[model samples]
Target: MAFVHSYQDDDDAPAAAATSLRRMELLLDPSLPQHLAGLALSQRGVLTTGQLLAAGLNRTRIHDIGRRDGWRTPLQGTRMVAVQTGPDASQDLMRAWNQAAALVLPHAALGFDSAAVEWGLVGVPRCDGVTVIVPPGKELRARPGLRVLVRPLTTHDVVSPWGLRTTSMVRTLADLLPTLDRPSGLAVLDGALRRRVRRSDLATARERARGSNGWRQVDDLWELANPDAETPLESRVRSRMIDGHLAPNALQQRLRDSSGRVYARPDMTIDRHRRRRPERGPLYIEADGRGPHGSPGAAYRDRDKASDLLADGADIERFTWDDTFDPMRIPWRLRRAL
Candidate 1:
């Protein structure tokens, strides 16, 4: 009764094929304890108790499945039958939880960080629970790992791109920006811009949110949003730089050798004129995310780039995901280098 890990977009084909085989087996087998083939296939092995009952499983049978080794009741009445073991398991489980939330409260739409996750916005921190927003006066009790908020949402604010009722990208950003910390907020904005959420659209969203709580902060985040930021870590590094009055003069700035051939494109750059001590040299800041910069080959290339920049009379600084957390860490180093 070992459950198979659910398939995610980035999961290897073998894992997806395995999950598909399991799903096909569940669908084709009539002797299965719960005749929930259709529901299981559609919901990714997540089913509500109500769905279980409607699918002809009695309370006793449901209880038996709940006690089984591979099955779990993640929410009050939602049953999740999957092995939460692999790297993508948590994300798969999260999707299931979101599905369960939608199933349980068909009237409410996913909002806030949950909607951001649904929209695939980058820099969205992982949340164990789902956040659903209901209109004012709606009475919904909060369950374990489920948050219910009362807010006024118009038809324009909601969308179901994937058949899961959730906020639109603009609405999600508008609702989520103010709630996040400064660095996280800027990161989300930069990510949204990278995803092609136009600056004008964000401006309109900001204007609509005028006079609301945290509007100023949202506006500031909108101003800081740059499509040139290629990653959440880069956006976060820029945020810290701005916080410490060390904002870079350019992002993804290109460096050229004497022959005018592009050598390296640093994540952030400050020209010598912008430097506190112009004689020190131009500064290049690298926001090194793990995936691209962690490999040995990447490390070698990075060293080569650093050497070339150093030889060119440029001061180089590299920051990682961890370095951005300390507000003073990046700024202090850059200041000393400057």
Candidate 2:
């Protein structure tokens, strides 16, 4: 309920509100601009100048509304109203942020990793800021905090998830495949498959990507993806092994002692058949080579398990995040252990 600052007074209120949705919502009258308010609800309570006109707010009245209501233009020609909320703003990804960006640009849709995040996809690369893909010929300008891409988007290639215009899940994955390494791409596929998206979901996407630049890589990931992967770490480990041409014998393979006593289920396993060199022997690998070992008790338990595995004559290799990123380390270590 605080008109923190006046928009007409030339204060920096607009810029401040642009980055904070809670503050922006506080300035809008939900009852007056019914359509704009409804649209803004999906756009982080932020509206564009064009949307204002669509809502029946004339140019003069729009200016009057801006001055009277403290509407700020964070980006040129964009308008926002601040609402009230706590000082603790989360840095975690917000769907409303992308909605606002898309709503600002005509025919703009969130694409690639942007769409993937909106669909709650897991195991892809960590992305920040916003990415907006506009249909070719749309008059949109690049803005800070937004990456604008122009492409020819087809009917099947686009979707509206989270009430925001974005590329379809299939198209989104295809868009992201080339940008990521094989392992990172598998993580995305594995995550999607875990959510029950099968190879069938990608049929149209595969057809569309025929002969495209990264089609081969995407195709490989589609076939190589295993829903058994429970985490991004696991997918990354599998990817490195594949890169080294060391396909696992089985994912999440169960381990047992001579008497069939199940010990631990490592993320991946190499059976006698999958072993490239018989001398290197059977292998079991854990994605978390480095233990979080939050407590001394936890550390002791892990050490105990390691001791047991050693006694069983199992060749185990542990890979950490650092090892996964280094092209030489994890693959080379895995090869040596195998």
Extract clashing residue pairs from model 2: 23-82, 23-83, 24-81, 24-82, 24-83, 25-82, 25-83, 26-82, 26-83, 27-82
Best by TM-score: 1
The per-residue C-alpha lDDT of model 2 at residue 94 equals: 36
Best by lDDT: 1
User: What Cα-based lDDT does every candidate model obtain?
Assistant: 0.76, 0.67
- Model 1 regions more than 4 Å off: 3-38, 84-90, 258-260, 276-279
Question: In candidate 2, what are the lDDT values of residues 1-338, reduced to their tens digit?
Answer: 33332122112131122243333334665446545554554455467788777777788988886888777664556665554343312212334446567665647888876677666676667655577888877847787667888878899877653456778777887677777777788888888888777688766556666676766765777778889988888898888888888878788767677899887677788876566666544688877734454478867876787777767666788777777787677778876776
Query: lDDT per residue, candidate 1, 1-338, as tens digits?
Result: 44233333322231122232222122123445445654665775677888777767789977876675346666788877544455445555666777778777889999888787666676877889889999988868988898998888899988876668888777787778777778888888888877677888898777766676777765677887898999999999999999899999999988887899998999999789877776667899999998899899999999999998888778998899999889899889988888
Per-candidate TM equals 0.86, 0.70
Pick out the ten consecutive residues of candidate 2 with the lowest summed lDDT.
Answer: 6-15
